[model samples]
Target: MLGLKQSDLASKAMITRSVLLGLEQPGRKHPDQLALFQLRDALIRDGLTFVDATEAAGEGVRWAKPSGKVWVDCLKDARAMLGYSLDELSEKSGVGRYVIARLEKTDRKRINEEAARRLRDVLFDNGVVILAEEADIGAGVRLRSRVRPAK
Candidate 1:
């Protein structure tokens, strides 16, 4: 996986983080083809290759080549998909907001494992799919549906 901040990736992809966050929602409508291509190209430059489903595995993304640096944890992706602000997630999960932010940045040093578990549980309970490693697919997260009803 590549290690780029949302703002950085959005810049390279010619998209905004808000757009990237919207696209992450499961069951959301697709963006324009040009925007999609831009995002794909940006990710390709970051060493990801989009995979197509076959007999051995399902459609997903894979590293096109070895890359260094730890990527942001799935927590941030799931949180965005669920539309929960860090403060909201912290309150719901009973984890400190600071710690939640740290986890999102992949800065887990001195972080409590129990606190992280609690945070993950909150995300899972509210319709986020915490994907585990399967076949060659890496661990990731997705939303099953939006967490709250639309206004």
Candidate 2:
């Protein structure tokens, strides 16, 4: 989901690929807590979320939502958080201004993958990191360390 290879993830997590693979393999012993937490946090930083099983759904991985709110709000909040006006976001994302306007105004508007990908890339570039919902925590966006909130 994060489009990361084993080596890439291992490097990001500061762990050996073999150790990461061991953790993935069934029947193998779990890695040490520190190693596991390191890997988890690393993945989280890159927009991967681990979900526990609930009565309705089995345990699985979910990509962070592209934006913070459900639909229109998501786009607006993401843009606001990055201090990007619709025009700036449109320019940065290579998406048309009209499309972004429609996205922010229309409720439950569905966007094609390409457009979504464009916006997502722009958001990430500006430090708006989306996180998937967990058992008790809801999905949201977080700024990277270097990103300051807009005044």
Candidate 3:
């Protein structure tokens, strides 16, 4: 439940209330990608395990099933675990608020290589371990990483 109201969940999930209501009802079609992911994370925080579609549909679709927790989720959790806010992270990392927000939200489909490297360095400096790997893209390049906070 994450202590969030239905309307709040809908707003955060970027879907309409009716859509969220329908998703909550039995036998209704599941929410789309964004909403589903958001709802799954919220549920996970509340100790609920979500059966990811990518896992169930394995190999049929080329979807990257989120392996364990996502890097962004790790970042958010690490920050919270350290009792740091976005503003504090921004100041500590010397990364701008907008840039940090963009990274956290994954607003862009791709991030600049230099930016990604700098982000990796900053996170590492903050006791967060991050490993980046280059992924094959048809034409463009992609970077994938696993992140966790150092204990």
Candidate 4:
């Protein structure tokens, strides 16, 4: 719609043409964060508000999840918005790369409280909000940082 063909837009957005076509058609699944943001920016440049474009695009989707895993997702979003990388975050936060990798993966079970606190601080310093909630687990300790933003 920005004087560019669907294929051109897809290429510019670094997504496949099928994704672009799917976004154009109604009732299709919503795009991921990167794609959604790229489309949003393009639409805004063409005089459409981001909220309106997002609403129009996701008209039929009953629920849309936030991007990223709690720790990983928050870090990714903050890094992207703040123009940093995993290595930079590790260096700045003093969290090991292996720990960061494990946290981003699905197998993560436990994270030290200190590490979690440090991560929260790093993300907050970058202007990202970190919300940690606890859920009950039997009669023992509760689970922490269960739900996170999508990547």
Which candidate gets the maximum TM-score versus the true structure?
Answer: 1
Q: Which candidate comes out best when scored by lDDT?
A: 1
Any runs in candidate 4 off by more than 4 Å, and if so which?
A: 1-38, 41-73, 131-151
Steric clashes per prediction: 0, 1, 0, 6
Q: Put down candidate 3 lDDT per residue, 25-87, tens digits, no spaces.
A: 646554566767776665544443322223222111111232343344234434543456879
lDDT per residue (tens digit) for residues 63-133 in model 4: 02232334433444344434567788789899886676666544567756677678667766655443322
Q: Which stretches of candidate 1 lie over 4 Å from their true place?
A: 1-7, 14-31, 48-72, 133-135, 145-151
Task: Assess each prediction's global lDDT (C-alpha) against the native.
Answer: 0.69, 0.66, 0.49, 0.50
Arranged by lDDT, best first = 1, 2, 4, 3
Residues forming the 10-long window of minimal summed lDDT in candidate 2: 65-74
Q: Return the TM-score for each candidate structure.
A: 0.59, 0.45, 0.37, 0.41
Clashes of 2: 1
CA lDDT of 7 in candidate 4?
Answer: 84
Model 3 Cα RMSD, Å?
12.4
Rank by TM-score (best first): 1, 2, 4, 3
Ten-residue segment with the worst summed lDDT in candidate 4?
136-145
For candidate 1, the per-residue lDDT at 37 reads 87
Which runs in model 3 stand beyond 4 Å of their true positions?
1-73, 131-151
Candidate 2, residues 1-151, lDDT tens digits: the string is 4547899999999999998888887566546787798899998898756655445433434455443434233556567666798889988888998888776664544766577667877887776655445554445455543422255
Question: What local lDDT score does residue 41 receive in model 1, on the 0 to 100 scale?
Answer: 99
